[model samples]
Target: MRPQENYMVIISPGLLVQLMERTGDGRSVSVRELADAAGCHPSKIDALRNGRREKSTIDEALAIAKRLGVDLLVLWEHTGRTVPVPAEPPHIAAVPA
Candidate 1:
């Protein structure tokens, strides 16, 4: 059976920062708050906001977008890059004695 491949999800640092800016009602959103809402680590959000990180898992991206009240495509996008899944080793037939 062929293994499922994975693709890269690019997160726009600028867009993420912008979205985070407007997250709180009249107030700025904190990294910890956003992280909690997104079910991720605060450092993850900080990295994405500061352009230190550009990639995220689809689930993470979706959670972040949902928490920010925006569509997933608004801040995250799928890239052409794909990680191929490793195939299993072939089975060898033993010679009968």
Candidate 2:
């Protein structure tokens, strides 16, 4: 296999807490302030921060990244993707018998 083909950057969820903590250079931004800036609800931010929620939408993630003055991709851990997501997500075809 070609080396280039083997290179894949997979970004997972759950980096919100770190990003929030790092937003102010270790000072950390308030949930309300972050929520206002990132265009997401404070409760959602709290959820992510406290691990009440497992993941966040890409828009929210990008917003947090933008507010933090960092690249969104940096927030995610690089795990090699063994399976690629489809361009068009597959819809459930049936409930099964």
Candidate 3:
């Protein structure tokens, strides 16, 4: 018998929406602008916000995070429940494995 592979799911649309809302004030940015910044289509961003898209590329997420001025890991933590940054700045470190 073959064993089923265990997959680790990371990030969620709700969390993404939360981060976006937090940074964008629900209108701080438009879908078109987010798409342009993320190098993706507006529909993709819409889908992500609406919970239709579950998987996201690291580059895409990073770009969005950069645009939002939020830490990539902070957003990841919002979805994955994993803290990738420390409480302090300048000496920020990844959560120990």
Candidate number achieving the greatest TM-score relative to the actual structure: 1
Clashing pairs in 3: none
Give the winner by lDDT: 1
Candidate 2, clashing residue pairs? none
What tens-digit string does per-residue lDDT give for candidate 2 at 34-82?
8888797898778656654534555666677678777867763322364
Ranking by lDDT: 1, 3, 2
Question: For residues 63-82, what per-residue lDDT tens digits would candidate 1 score against the true structure?
Answer: 87777878888776675545
Show the lowest summed lDDT stretch of 10 residues, model 3.
83-92
TM-score list, all predictions: 0.66, 0.53, 0.58
User: Which is superior by lDDT, 2 or 3?
Assistant: 3
User: In candidate 2, where is summed lDDT lowest over 10 consecutive residues?
Assistant: 85-94
TM-score computed on alpha carbons, candidate 1 = 0.66
TM-score of 2: 0.53
Off by over 4 Å in 3: 1-10, 22-27, 77-97
Q: What's the true lDDT of residue 39 in model 1?
A: 84
